[model samples]
Target chain A: MRNRLVVQLVDFDLAAEYRRLCELDGAVGAVVTFCGLVRDCEQQAPIDSLTLQHYPGMTEASLGDIVASADRRWPLHGITIIHRVGELLPRDQIVFVGVASGHRAAAFQAADYLMDYLKTRAMFWKNVAHGGERQWVDCKDSDRQAAHRWSQDPKRQ
Target chain B: MIKLLFFGRLGDATYAAPEVFEASVGLTAAGVRDALSSLYPALGRALFEPQVLVSVDRVIVDWQQPLLDGCELAFLPPVTGG
Candidate 1:
């Protein structure tokens, strides 16, 4: 039942987050974490910076819902999701998803599900600055497909 | 009053500041879109584009969704965050 959901303009500490998840329960045997980083290049062009925009109230609510859904689907000891907003340079951490469970299978799958849903369901947008031009990033078809796969067989894993 | 929010590209295309208007009875989400569209044609095209989502009070709803006083209506482009 130890769950942490945060949306902030500042960065998060992965080590501290991992330790928190580790101490969630004595039964926790596996911890899975995923961190998304800003890339240095988009397509073939070098990028200057990336700006993340999000609906303040809606973004937090959406993250809460995604975490709740993951909790229902798995027997997790803890879950942590932190997403950063505002301007960020290349290689900056953009998102972090961590799940702790009694077993590796549950922990791994829950973390994966959390990320897939976050990419599509969360109300956050990314805009990239490249060559002095800025543009909003578009949702990828592959990401849609990845999220769709989870719905296809909910009972699996 | 109904508060309208535009995010991402929509915010850039239109006003970044939240727009507020007096909420009249029988007003629907589509009505607001039409009202804004007539005033901003370029934004109107973007609003009509595929994948643009409309949310009322933080929840996604159809265009026919009715508005309530003091509700927050947000127009969101397809989200790309990880």
Candidate 2:
């Protein structure tokens, strides 16, 4: 089905990933992609770098479940999710989510849904280096709220 | 034996390598947590926190979940990745 779910220590090519989604099916008229980059500052402090840690087997499995949930919600032609691990400097790409569908609304919503779930459901943990100190990033209540909204959608139920 | 793993801040707090623990009969996830807490007090406190989660063989489970021999047990802190 041309779905790509990956967690790696290397960066990914957004163009290449988008092209793969386009080629998944001739009916795919829309492809939406979301790329996440490390911010340069955290809490007004200039960040030096970020390190991501993840559980090996569980991380991949969790990604699969997220994709599956998205597929169940929308009519998606293809999906691509790539998350980078290990040390990353500011502005470095940390994650990519792409969705292709027969129409724009499905593609857009699915991509949004994928990203929301990935932020909260995926197993990767982010640790930031800033102001000569290192601290693990805490899960934001907003991220949890974003994920919760999807479940609260009456259409899904 | 159950293999134990810690991630994120929990990993840093414990500075632990993946360790094997002998699982006695009818060992529950809570039992393992209590046992490990005595060994690593910092980890104990973290695990008792509201956000920490326990996974058995890579699947999130409740504290009452039973452990089987050769299973992997992991304590996950609140995840923050995009």
Candidate 3:
């Protein structure tokens, strides 16, 4: 099985996750992954940190739904999904999506698709600590645009 | 009646959740926006031409939503996540 999904409140062990993903090998020749880091900049505000929160039971279900969507959309051999909730500082990893496939194309595209959808369609939001103050933020227009492009009937192959 | 709620800057300017007198009209989102613009003049300055969008039921919605009675509408700004 090449699918692994995790939605945890604790800090994820990156090394263990990397190991579990590589344990199975079939059609996978390459595994590509991306981990998003909380940065100090958010639309020009000097962000101190962020507390990402979600509707617990529903968030995992949604992550599973998204990973399944990617599997149907791309031919893949292995997949790993991890997301972080609770407070995080700058440079702290917030999310990770990795995919393994027969070739680089599947891995690359699926990773991108997962993130694009996660940024927009996912029901996670943040209580952002910016410039000594905190507030909530909605999904970015770029993320929406990225999601809109995902439905391009031609790219699913 | 439904509330077209706002948060952050939108909330601060209006100082409360701005209400539309015809919120009970079962209006389309676009229509609700127009109602707010007319009823709360400040909403016209703050939200009439916003750099942001709205989300309903935790998902990005189009200008049209088949809102039934008692649907809590949430107005949101663009999200920035790591």
lDDT of each: 0.90, 0.90, 0.70
lDDT of 1 at A12: 89
What is candidate 1's lDDT per residue for A53-144, written digit by digit as tens?
A: 99988899999999999988899999999999999999999999999999999999999999999999899999999988898889999999
**Model 1 DockQ (Cα-based):** 0.87
Per-residue alpha-carbon lDDT of model 2 for A33-65, expressed as tens digits?
999999999878899999999999899999999
Which residue pairs in candidate 2 have backbone atoms (N, alpha carbon, C) closer than 3 angstroms, thus clashing? none
lDDT of 3 by residue, A1-157 (tens): 5688776667777777766666667556778888888878877888888887664454676677888899898878778888888888988888988888888888889999899888875546777787677777766777888878878757554
Model 2 achieves a DockQ score of 0.89
Where is model 1 more than 4 Å wrong at Cα? Answer: A154-157, B13-18
Q: What is candidate 2's lDDT per residue for B1-82, written digit by digit as tens?
A: 8998888888884356447889889999899888878887777787889888999989999999999999999989888979
| CAPRI category for model 3 | incorrect
lDDT of 3 by residue, B1-82 (tens): 6655664456654344454324444566666666666767776566655655554554547767756555556555444433
- The residue pairs that clash in candidate 3, if any, are A138-B78, A138-B79, A139-B79
